[model samples]
Target chain A: MVAALRERVRLACSWCENAIGFIQESRLPNGARRVGAGTMAFRMFIIGLVLVGSLAAAPAAWAYSESDPSANPDIDPSDCESCHTGTPEIAGTEEARQGPHANYSATSRSCYACHQVHQAYADGYLLMPGATTTETCELCHDGTGGKGVYGALEARGLAVASQHRTEVTTQIPGGDEATGGMATAALSGYQGTLSCGDCHSPHGGGTVEPFTTDRSRIETDVAGFFSNQLLRRAPTGATYEIGVYGSDWCAACHSGRASGVHDLINHPVDTSATVGPTAFTYESVQVVDGVDSPQTVQGSLGRSNFGYVMPWPRTAGQGTHAPVCQQCHEDGRSVGDVASGRIKASEVFTVTSADGGTAGDNPRFQNFPHESYVENLLIESYDDLCSNCHHPNQLP
Target chain B: MTPDAAVTPVNSRMRIRRSMQILSAVLLVVLLVLLVLLFRELLTGAPEYPVSQEGIRPLHVILGPGVGNRPFFDGPMGVTFGADGRIYVADSGNHRVVVFDSEGEYLFQFGGLGVGKPAAGIEPSWKPGLFNYPTDICSDDVGNIYVADFRNDQIQVFDADGDFLRVFPDRNEPLGRGASGQDGAGIAVTSLTVHGERVYATDTYQVAVFSTEGELLDQFGRPGAEPGDLDHPNGIAVGAPSVVVVSNSNRNQVLAFAPGGRFMWSFGKPLGNDLAGLSGELELPRGLTIMDDGTVLVADALADSIVRLTLAGEFDGRFGTRGAAPGQFNAPMDVDEADNRLAIAEKGNDRVQVIVIED
Candidate 1:
C-alpha cells in the first residue's frame, strides 16, 4: 500500500508541474490584448487538472496517517501536508523541502521539530518547547545539536555577557518605543528582545546556513537556491547572487545611515561605489601549534565566510573595502552615532595581545579577536579605525 | 543456407515490432495521465482568498499615491487635519512635515535636512526644528501644530504657517527630569494628542501630560499586560472633554483614561484566528483618532483595516481591505478622523490615503 501511495503521489506531482508549465507558457506578450478564447480554455483545462491532481493526492496524504500511526504521534503530521502540499498548495514549500533542515537527516526534517501545535512557549509563532524564540533555536542550534550557531555566538559572547547581548533581559540603550526611527525601535521585530530568529529564519524559506569556507565558490553554486545566512540579498531588481553585497536587509530596521540619510556626511553603505583601498580588510591568521604567526592573512568577501571585509562592493580601481552597518556597530551603539563617527569600534571584534605584549594590534594585520579587552566593544580607539586601514604614519 | 537466413531476418523484424509496441503503450499512458492532471487543475480554479474581507468596505480613498499634486510619501506615519481644513503629514522618512489643502493640493513643507536651528540655551547638537523621525502629529484648535519628534525625544510645536515655536519638556526646566533622574526621562516619545489645554505624549511606559506651554503637568501609566497598564502604547488621541484614548500596540487593545490619569476602561481582544468581527479584536493596533461624534477609529496594522468604536469602547463597525488598490490598505500605521473623512497613513505602501466616510 505504501509503495502504491508513493507512486501515485509522484505521478500527481509530475502532472501538477506540467500544468504549471503550460500556464506559464500560455501567458500573453506585453501590451497584448485580453487572453484569447483558446487561452481561457487552456486555463480552464489547467484548473481541472489541478483539481484532479489534488483528488489523487488526497489518498496519499491519508496514507501517512493510516500506515504510520506512531509517526509524530504528538499531533497529526498529515494536517500540515494536507493543505500545504496535495490541495491548494502553498508556494515555497517545494523550495523549503529542499532546505538542509528538511533533507539533512530523517529526524530533523519534521515540522514539529521546530514548531508546536498548541500553546507555544513563545508569544507569536508556535515555537517548540523553549522559554523564548532564541531558546527554541538553541535547542538544535547548540554546539551538540547540529547547526552550532548558538555555540559560535556563545563562544564569542555575542549571545550573552558581551557588551551587545541577544538575551531578553539585556537592557537596550534606547527606549522600547517605535520612534519612527530605526534606532529607538531597533528591536521591533524581536518583540523587545534580540534573538537568533531575528537574523535567521528556521523555516528555511529565505535563509541559508552560514558559510564557513570557500564563500565565493559556494555563493556561485547556490546562486538562487537560498538567501545568505544573514538573510541578506541584493536590492530588488539587482542582478547578483543570493549573498552578494546587500545591506538593505540591515537597513530595513536601521534606517538612519543605511537609508542614505548620511550619504554625503558619512561612510557610504549599500552603494555600488567601492570603498577606497585605504579601508581595512579581514585576513586569516595561521597558528603554528598553539602560537599565532605574525604573517598577515586575507579574509573572503563572502558573508558566510565570516570575513572581516564589509559586505559592500569594493572600489573599482582602489579595491577599497566598503563596509556594511554590522561591520562597525552592534546593538549597543546606535546606527546614527556610528554614522556620525561618534562610535568607532564594533562590539563584534575584540582584541587581546599574546606573550604579554601590548593589547592593541592593527586589526588589518591581525586576526579578528573573539572578545574585547575593554568594556566597550572596541578593539581600539576611534582613531585606530582609520589607522587600521589608512596606516596613521601615512597620514599628514 | 538461404532458408536459414530468411528465417532469422523475419524473427528480427518481429522482435523489433514488439519493442516498438511496448514503447508506444508507455508513451500513451503518460500522455493520458498528463491530460487527467490538466483537467483537474482546470476544475480547481485559482486559489481562494487567504482571508475573507467581505464584511467591511471603505466608502472612498483620497490623497493616495499619484492622487494629489503633493510629492509622494516615502514613509508616512502620522496624519491630521488643521483647524482651517488643511492636512498635515509627518513624512517621517523625508524628515519633514508636509501640508496639503482641503482639496489635497500641496501647500508647503518644512524641517528637511540642515533646515533646523536649535533654540537659544538648547544644546547646539540638538537640531531644533529638524526632525529625525517624526512619528505622530497633532494640531490644536488655533492651528498650532504639535509634532512628536520620536527620535529627538521631544515634542516640537509649530505655528499654522509652519514656523517653529518652541520645544516641549524644556531642557532648561526640571520637567525634563524623571523620578529616577534626568537620564531616564524624555526618551522615545512615540505619539501625542492635544486636548483643551493639555498635550498627552506617550513615552514607552507612561503617558506624560504637558501643558500647552510645554510644562510637564503629570505622567501616569506603567508597563504591563494588565488593564490600565501600557505594554507598548504607540498611539494617543482625545475623545470627549476629559477622555483620553491610547492604543497599546503590543497588547493589541486600546485603553481609555479619564481626567487626572484614572484608567476608565479597556477594550479589544488579543490577536487570534478570528480575522472578521464587529467587536474590537485587533492585531497590532497602532494609530487612532476620535471623531466629533465621540467615535474612536483605530488602525489595525496587521489586519489592514480601521475599526470604529464608540466613546464607551463598544465596537461600531470597521472598513478597509488588504491590498494596494484604492480604498485598500497595506499595513496602515495610523488613522485620523477629519471633516467626515479618514486619513490613513499606510506604512507599507508609503502613502497617506484619505477615505471619505459615508453616512
Candidate 2:
C-alpha cells in the first residue's frame, strides 16, 4: 500500500509536467512566430500552480510520516502531571506502590503508552487508541505488539485447549453471584467473554503480598507487579465468601468445587482435614546410613517446611483444612525463565525487603495452562499435595 | 499560408479549431480530478478517527473515597444532581449519602449507620442525621437533599452543605408505603425523584408523588405486567412522557403514565434479548434520567451500560461497558444528568462514574 501511494504521487508529478509542457508547445498565428519567452514562462508557472494545488488536496502525496505516530512529539507530561503522581507511596514506606501503571516499563513512561490524551476515541473507561479492553491490552500485549508473554487475546483464544473458557461474553465478575457456574449456567447462545479486565486491573499497580494470612487483607492488595500478571482478587485463606474475596473469587463460578454444595468432589474443600486422632501427630520412620532410626513427630496437619513453601493454597488460621484451588492449580506454563545477573528464574523471583534490603528470592507461578497441566496433569499428584494433611490407609 | 492551401473551407477550419480547444480544456480538468482522487486513497487514511459518535464520553471516576481505608462501599445505589448542581450519591450499603462537586470530586458526606465506616460493620440508626441503608437520593427546589432512608422508613431531608434539615412525617412511619406497596406494610421508599412541586417516589409496587413539604400530593400505578402496571417497580422519573417506572418483573419493562394517574405508554418487555441492547433492547434497566432534550438514559446493570431512549420510548443510543475503567461500569444502579455532566452510580464497582455529555 505504501509503495502504491508513493507511485501515485510520482504519476501526479508527471501529469503536472505534461500540462506545463503543453503550454510550451504553443505556436503563433503566423507560421514561424513563436510566443514570447516571458509569456511562455508565465504560462508554465500557472501550470505549476495547478499542480501544487492538486497535491495539497491529497496530503498523503507528500506527508510521508502521516502513518507513523512516533512522528509526533510525546504527550506533554504537564497535561496530566498536575494530578497523577509519577511515584505513589504504598502502605509500607519501602513497599512503594508507585501510583498506578507507573513502574515496570523499561520503555519511556510517555503517558502515550495507553492514553490518547487529547483526541482519544474509545467510548470511555479511558479506552483510547483501541476499542475493547482486549484491544487496549493488545496494543502492547500481542506477540508482535508488546510481546506480552501472557497476552489477553491468547487466553481467550486458547479456551478450547482445556484453558478456562474465557470466550463466553457474559458478566459473571464474582462468578454467578448466585448458584455458581459460567454465565451460560441458565441462558445459552451469547455470553460475556471473561476478558483480561475480569481478573486483573489494568491500572492495578501496588505492593505484592506473597500469600494471604488474614482473611480481611484479601479485600485489598490486588495486582502484584507488571512482569507478573495482575490478579485483582487474589484469594484469601478463609472460606470463599461469595463475590467478596478469598477462595470464593474462584468458587464464584466453580461452585461445584466449593465446600458443602460440591457433592461431585466428595472430598469437600474448606473442610477440616484434622478430624481423626493421632498419637502426638502421626509417627513416621526414617533411617541413617549405618543405624536404623525411627523419626517421630507431632501431627501438624498443614505445615510446610520440607525445604520449600510447597506450591499450595494459603491456609486459614493455623492451616488445617482441605486444599483450596491455589494449592495445586497454579498459573504460568512453567517457572519464569532465568533472567541475567540474578538467581535462577524458575518459580522463584527476586525480592527486596522493607528496609530496601535484598531478600534472596520469592517464588511465583504465572500465566498458566502450562503444557498439559490444565487438562491432563497437575503441579503434583494428589498424593503429594494431600499427604501433608490426610494420612490415608489402603481400602480392603 | 491560407493562400497556399485553399482545399479546405475557411468556415469548416474555424469550427474545427474551436472543437479541438474545448477538448483540450476538458481533458486537462479530468486529469486534475483523477490526480486528487488517487492522492487521497494512496495514503493511509486519517490516523485517528472517532471510535464512537455518541454524544457523551467518560471524563472521570470516583472510586469510593473510604474513611481511613476501611472500604466504604458495598453498593453506591443512587445518584442525582442537587439544586446546587453538586453530585449527591446514596451510599446505601453504608447507610449514608456521599456528596461530590459537579466534577465528581468528593466534597463532604453526611448520614450513615454506626461510625459510618464500612470496614467496622454496619449498625442500625434511625436518628434524623443518621440512617439505615439510605437507598434512593434526590434534591428539592432549594438544594435540600432527600434520601429514602430504607430501614429508617423515612424521607430524611438535608441541606446542600450536608447538614441535617428535618425528617419527613416527623413520626417514625408517617412516610407511608403507599396503597398496598405504600400502606407502610412491609416496605420502605424504594425510589425517589423531584418534579415541579412534588417528589415522586416508589415503594416496592406503588408510586408516591408528594409535595416538597412532605404532603402526599398524589398516588398512582399498581403491580402487574400490563400497560401502566408496575411489578417490582424499583425506579421512577417524571419527564415529558409523564411518570416512567422500571419494573423488575419476569417481563422486565418500563411503563409510563399521564400526570393524572392514567396509563400512557410502556417499553422493554420480557427485557431486551441482548446485553448490549440494540435500539430499544435492554438487560437489567435500573435508575433513569430524563435529559433536557427529552431523551431518557436508563442504567442497565447486567449490560454494564447506560441505555438511552427518546421520550416516546424509542432507542436513541447507549454508552459504557462492564469494567472498572473510567467509563466502564460494574453493575451500574443509577444515573443522573445535570448541565451535560452525567453522574453514574455503580453497585458492583462501589463508585460513581462521571462523564461529560456533549451537545
Which candidate tops lDDT? 1
Candidate 1, residues A1-396, lDDT tens digits: the string is: 123234555766776687677657666677453566444454544466455556555533422322245655765542555434532112222222322233222223235334434322212234344445665454323221122233232331122223334555323332222332324333412456555554444444444333332221112222332323333232222233233323444344333444234433345653322332233322221111111112223443222212322211222322333455434432121111222222234422221211011123222111112223223443344653443334333347
The candidate 2 chain B region of ten consecutive residues with least summed lDDT is B271-280
Model 2 residue B98 lDDT? Answer: 80
lDDT at A57 for candidate 2?
Answer: 44
Off by over 4 Å in 1: A1-198, A202-396, B1-70, B114-127, B171-187, B270-280
Q: Write the per-residue lDDT of candidate 2 for residues B194-290, one digit (tens) a residue.
A: 7777778765456777777778767776544346665445567888645554434223466677786787666775421122212225555667878
TM-score of 2: 0.40
TM-score of chain A, every prediction, order shown: 0.44, 0.41
DockQ of 2: 0.01
Query: For candidate 2, lDDT tens digit of each residue in A1-396?
Result: 123345556767786678756764676556543765444445545565566566554443233232244544563432445345453311112221211233323222324334534333323235333345664553323221121224221221222223443335444422432444434332121234555555544553332322321111111122322122233433222132222222344554554455655334334444222222211111111111111111212221111122112112222222443434443443212221121111123323222111001112122112333222234223333344443333233112
Quality class of the docking in candidate 1, CAPRI style:
incorrect
- For each candidate, report what fraction of the true interface contacts it reproduces: 0.00, 0.01
